[model samples]
Target: MNLYRKVVLSLVIALPLSSLVSAQDAVKQLADKLQVMDTLLANFQQTIKDSQGAVLQQASGVLKVKRPRRFYWRTETPYEHLVVTDGKILWLHDLDLEQVSKQPFSADMDKAPALLLSGEIAEISKQYQVQALTSQQFVLSPRTDDGVFKQLTLEFRGASISGMILRDSLDQTTIIEFSSVRMNQPLADEIFQFTPPKGVDVINNEP
Candidate 1:
């Protein structure tokens, strides 16, 4: 699967609802959570289901995130793909393909979900229009002519993000669930660096 498909397919689930929450309230709650977080470490269980409500795939991993665009997503699952991003570049390594892909941070800054990884919370409001709070989630739709991703739904447990549902322009939905999250943990910058192995195909998609 491609990167977008892999990411989109990883968030389906059939778990019970943990609580009753409001979307408007959740938006405020999400904003507060992001506002307060400088760094974070956590284990996540992502269960992706199809539109028919069938489980497609499941993956678990430990995520380490630092402020100003840095993340380490190490997967322990059916397949392995390592994604890392420094403030300057994004690296995606496919274990199965033994291939590495790199892109300039600025080239795909708007298209890539870099803001979601970094502490760039200030621009979210400017780029998207916040909708009314729902019973279990808050919704936001992009205000610009951005390609593909049409809307984003965020599900929360009190303050922390419990899940995220993304809808593309094609009406395909991708849901992401986050659990056991630890916030404000110290992280080393070296963890985000990428060095491709010998003989592996390297695709540089940066402009």
Candidate 2:
């Protein structure tokens, strides 16, 4: 599976050091919030809408993330699909099809919005221009054209990430609202490990 597509995955703020102090401060605060956690587990509701605001799809799921590139994501609505990465390999499983596809984890996955929580603060600053929209909201615009989304906005409610909005080049928007967020919680290592079920086809794409 194409990680970006499957994940619905989707900057440089410029200013004098002194003039940017407040912006920098906001960025730092958000970064600190993200970095304080080793693991995060949350329930999420995602909606995709077209430019005209017509609903295209909706899904609800659970997500687990471990720092430095490990995550388990499952969609429990309309159908069931699971994507797991153990910092080295990525697995995409389709329960209905009873098939699993595996590939070596690649750095590009870092661009996924969910993974940003595990990324370095300095790297985030370098990759996107950050603007504080409100005390609890921030807008990030990519520095390059390679990203999957045109821009992303993150909303925080007292240090807890509350929502994310991703707008792609096609003008389609994907909004994800998170709840039941548990941060820095101990997650089993097995959760990040994946083994194909009995009789399921396995396709390995690793190089």
Q: Predicted candidate 2: what Cα RMSD to the true structure? A: 4.0
Which pairs of residues collide in model 1?
12-47, 12-48, 12-49, 23-133, 23-134, 24-133, 39-184
Per-candidate TM-score against the hidden true structure: 0.77, 0.86
Candidate 1 lDDT over residue span 96-205, tens digit each: 77878887765235334424646476666555555545545656776675664677776667655576677655555566667787777677899878888899999998
Candidate 2: where are CA atoms >4 Å away? 1-23
TM for candidate 1 is 0.77
The collision pairs in model 2 are 11-127, 11-128, 11-129, 11-143, 12-128, 12-129
- How far residue 171's Cα lies from its native spot in candidate 2, in Å, is 0.7
Candidate 1 Cα deviation (angstroms), residue 17: 27
After TM-score superposition, the amount by which residue 194's alpha carbon in candidate 1 deviates from its true location, in angstroms, is 1.8
Write candidate 2's Cα lDDT for 9-77 as tens digits: 241002223347876776786687677778888998988888899888888889888886778888888
